[model samples]
Target chain A: MNHNLPVLVLAFPLLAAFAVNLLGKISKKHVAPWTLASLILSAGTSLWVLKDVLQNGKFSYTVGGWMAPYGIELVLDPLSALMLVMVSWVALIATFSALPSIKKEMPGREHLFFSLYLILICGMMGLVITGDAFNLYVLLEITSITTYGLIAMGKGRAPLSSFNYIIMGTIGACFYLLGVGYLYLLTGTLNMADIASRLPALYESPTVATAFCFLIVGVWIKMAFFPLHGWLPNAYTYAPKGASVLVAPLMTKVSVFLMIRIMFSIYSPEYDFLMHLGIKNLVVWAATIAIVGASLIALTQKDFLKMLSYIVVAEVGYMVGGVWLANQEGLTGAIFHILNDSLMTLCFFLVASAIAYRTGSSRIADFRGLFQKMPLTMLALSVGALSVVGVPPTCGFFSKWYLLLGGVEAGQWEFVAALIFSSIVNAVLFYRVFEVAFSHSEEEPSLKFENSRILETSPMMIPPLVVIPVVLLVIGLSAGPLVREVIRLAVPAL
Target chain B: MDAWLFEIIGKFNYWIYVVLMMTGFYAMIRKNNLIKKLLGMNIFQTAIILLYISMGSKVGGKIPILDKEQALAGAVQVADVVNPLPHVLMLTAIVVSVSVTGVALAVALRIYKEYGSIDEDQILERIGKS
Candidate 1:
């Protein structure tokens, strides 16, 4: 049963995506419901797998019943288990919410949308599950290619944005392959555990150093560190609402996880030379720039989703900086922030999608009197916005708190400043939208605004309002316990 | 520095790998055409493939075709063979690289049809106006 589970998890989605693509010809009506149903079941199975992991400590399944170090292996420990559940849960919610939005937005591309969506989920899951380094790259490419396709489905300028994303993403994946090549050249192995055991002896060689550099740069691209993040804003802004909601939450976070695995697991912290290479300080500085720069840029955007796009860039910095701090608290904050930021970003983008659905625009100016126009959605948006601004009682605040504390504990005051600057900039950005949403439009309709419906948009408003707040509350309330657990799992990596 | 160069070049395979990587990177950065850029990406990917294959090499080793009779003879009595693992891995990586390139080319063709240009600057100009 254990031997079969990993293949089963991946096969279900792989088959479903292919089926959806084929079935779209039979009847377009069968596409959306079938896609959603498969995702719901996928999410349930992922949760069950997570439960099994938490209870059993760890489980290893050798693909094709072959032994490890030779055959493909799928290992599920707490970290990956947590990630699987997070990816699937967010994906399920995002997929369901996407239905009506895509229905209206793309009009003719819903079947393709659902198919690419399923493929993206499968790719992310494959990245999380596969214990082979080379296989992870294969899955990463799958995710990137499918994502570019999905992002291009947006109306205008989307294909251009998707084109830029393809260039950057291709470079990123190539860099990762190069890095893996370096490691394989040194050790002649692709399995993570095998490479881990073999790597320390070769650390003195300059080839190892080169490999380290290659790996870090590669993952940094995917993680979208400051200088390399040129492709992100447009990609997020111009993609369809469904694509943005789906990709924004998991894509960068998964890359960061791979980075953590490489930095700590593949090359353990006990490597004396790696510590002396000033890699930590380099990461700290890059992350600081990313945090402050992205936040400030986010403040300058007029479009609501574009502004949120820059915030996502800033959020990546927070996680990268947190992890690079290389201490228990720092690592814990980084890991916890993954969950926090994923949910928070999901909420933000979902609300944006809902607003876009209602107003047919995501321009800040168009949101004037949105509070009256779409009360439930705007309320949810406000909560999500406040969360992004890192206020208490929202998930965003707790993660930022730990991140700030981690900086101080590591005596990295500049990073603390970055976090504070990020907070202020986020506040400004969120408030700009909030003001428009709250203010009354000068030319009010003759009809009473109170006559406006309770829920603004169907299939869109409901998911964000329900899923976003509940996630926010859960993170805020259970932060202490969650932080403790993240710390435990992060120990091996840090 | 001379000693370093000699040592690096003496391993001709590593030198070839480095040259291939540099060529690919240069083309990717310098090329104006999308197809040229993708060709560069292919070259860049192939360099890694060479690197992996080179890694699996052993001094005076034969191809790793497992002989059931020889293996059963004894654990100590064995053919000194090159590692086949990296080669196998590279085959998978090559397939993935090609698939990504194929998909990317398809997207690029679609992009060209949509915007009526294949050059980055012109494409950007058209997209910007949109």
Candidate 2:
């Protein structure tokens, strides 16, 4: 009965996206509810897959009943199971909040908005599940193109940013495709598991070395690792509110998952070139600079949404540094941080979406007396803010702890310093927002929210904002069991 | 000297791809005009497609189609057919590149509409003044 779950999880979204577009022509109000029903169904299937993977161990589903190497397959394991559930649920919540914003921002075009939205989700899920290298590239482009369309829907400077995204995204995808081409030339296979089995024999070959370089660098560009992150902040910050909320959270995180998948799964754990060339340390060192520089830049941004984009860049550094630390603790920390970071970033971006919905602004100075006007929203924002600042009993704190330990274990003092420095900088960044929010209340107490339901935003937006912070806390508290039961299985064989 | 010349000639296809791809790469980074950058991107994608097509070629090989009667006779040889995998992959890739190009052109049109020009520096100047 559950055998078709993997393909169903992917196929449902593709079908729902088109269905939503068609339904939009008939009725505007139906788009969000229709999309929600389908999203919930897809999220449930993802959970079922997660449960199945946890129980029976890893399984691969061959599409169209064809065999592997000749046919594409979806592999569900503990890592992908974690990502699938996290991304699907977060996407559902984001879509829910997006309803109010879309109605306000782009009223007549609701169907097309949801259509691109659902396709982006499909691309991300497909990126996570596919076990074939070439299939991964195909899915990545689907995600990228949908993302470009979605970002182009933003108001002022969006189209230009979308064009910039097209350039960088195509280059990244092409580099990845070229790498896969070289791999096929050498290994004569495209299935990831087959490639891994055949690769050790060619490890010393220059062809294999070049292929590895192209593939990982391509993924780095996608994830916006330090030097390659030029397109991310401008593209995301200028994107429409709804697009930024979802893309800001899932896009880079999924790319990081793909990076991990490629490095450890397709190449085997003994990818000793990092050690032989000392490039692992070089990667981690680069990550350290990304953390420091992004945090400092984030601090200077007056626009809250733009600041969050830089924080996303810094968070990318955390995961990259942790993974490249090349130890069990570091790897576990990196994988755990992906889940933690996605939830928190979704929380943060959702609040930004809500802010844009209400005041029609996310400028920090424009938020005068927001604490009094929208107390609940500010409260939710604080939870997100504190998590990013690495406060305890929040999920971010635990992930940072593990990452710091990993840094120490690897004896990388520079990374250790960068992590601490960024956390402190993040604290200052959020506190400054709070200071501005509270600064106005002392003198004029802005418009009092005696009937604050207006401040609460539409009823549709509140549920996601309230529910996400609670989940953040729950995930933080249960992080221990999560590592034991789930993350341990997900870490690389290395 | 003869062997050296022959080896270089044998790898001529790869050298051509490298040259074409680099030309595109240079234009993408060095050009200030948006349309030129778009053209460069197209060139870059076309070069990669050509690289994949060349990889599928064989001097003595025919098309990759299988003969039904020859299969029944059990007399098929692998070397007789050029590799079809890269060709199939590149076909899908060409479609993707075309979609990317379409989206990019649409965005470029929008940029021109909004800012009245696609020169990177002028656009930035307009954005700054606003």
Candidate 3:
């Protein structure tokens, strides 16, 4: 079992999903705690895996003791271990916060929600840890299908949005499958390591190049990179408050991590395929447009959640641009941004869910005088907003700084400018919301304590909100250690 | 005639697959009906399955079941049997695609129940009116 920590982590939550359903049927009240307990166990296994990776370097676990190249293997490197921990950790908090909203939005289907949610965690873990390319496709489908179910749980327009997500997501996954098929055609193997080893001989072939393009495009669509991002805003905006908190922060991010893993691990960072075709420049330019364009689009949204969803689109640009910049700092920035952005988005989305829970609406107009009503919640929201705006002493600022430094090193001044411009745009967008929330109306005075009718949503919701921002601050302050100790180990040699 | 046989017949399977895949892609992207798009997604996935299964075939290859006599006598020649891995992989892919289609149709059903139409334009028009 110790040796099988990789599979155990997946099995713990997966098997527990059914157990949670059983508890929900028999007890109904015991389901949340059971889900949390299993997730905590999963998180513990993730940390164990992380510690082992950091101390002993990478290890691979073959299912049923079967050998690789023929049998499926789960690879636990520092990168995937870190992602496992992050996904589980955030998922744990998201589940805790979910109880309040799930009960409200989906009273009867609570077990079903947890079941799909746990399966999503299982699938994401499989996607991250699996060393085989085709296995990744299967795991990707599992995550996608479960997410569509979770999203459609929303009250209005959610089913439609989820339907849209299904179309795009299926196309993306199938494109990836097609690409894997091409890779198999050239190399006669579907294991990533095996394919990478055999690929150097075929690097100049058009089929290989086409396969690469298919993969990048597929990943881009899944990540919702700017032009391909149409399906994201609606799916996230209209999803049940509980569901968005779970799906928004992790799905696109894990997809981006898979992109990085595909490029760096399955295909070596120094493969030069990116540079040979000047695809790096193309991706970088697209990232630039994505940052600026998505920010502008974000500013136009009056719905608070919709606006943040657009910010998610813009932040996706940051990571994509950083990775495509093709320098060490850029790569580190991209990878680090994945961590920072997930935390930031989680904090903000939780805040959105909490406010929606209390106020019964998520529009900007609903936020009026919110600072007076739920001061602690608003404080948490302020931290998340400032982080998105790249203010210092928050995790977002450090990642943005690294991204800027990366852009400078790469001499991609346009991307650098876009990053800086996005920070300002984010600041303005958040400030606009703040202005609405912090205003003093006739009913709510500037210094009236407890005068407004607003109260904090619940004890459960504030913990994740406060805890996430604190984690953000800690990660921001210890940025050097995290980069030197964790991210660098995960990134392959350039 | 031999050249024609080797070239045309050799590549026609892939050509048919390309046609099938494009039709799926076209319907998925261009069709106004949600159900049609779902159908298109199915076509696209099936085309891919066909492509993989076809790639696993060899003209002279037999079924992948092991011959006990040959196994006892010597190491089996792999080229004598068609590849079985793609078949197994596509089995998984087909299961996944079926799940996707089921979930997609369910969501579409819900959408239709809510909006009274499954046409993309009508849904958009309805939303605009609302």
Give the winner by lDDT.
Answer: 3
Weakest 10 consecutive residues of candidate 1 chain A by summed lDDT? A445-454
Model 3, C-alpha of A404: deviation from truth (Å): 1.1
Interface RMSD of each: 1.5, 0.8, 0.5
lDDT of 1 by residue, A180-237 (tens): 8888878868898899899999888888888788888888888788789988888889
All candidates: TM-score: 0.93, 0.97, 0.97
- True-structure RMSD for candidate 2: 1.8
Candidate 2 per-residue lDDT over residues A410-483, each given as its tens digit: 99989999999999999999989899887666666443333445747767889998998898889889989989
On residues A453-487, what C-alpha lDDT tens digit does candidate 3 reach at each position?
Answer: 44587678978977887898899899889999998
Candidate 2 global TM-score: 0.97
Candidate lDDT scores, in order, read 0.81, 0.88, 0.89
Q: Chain A: TM-score in each candidate? A: 0.95, 0.97, 0.97
Q: List the residue pairs that clash in candidate 3.
A: none
lDDT at residue A164 of model 1 (Cα atoms): 72
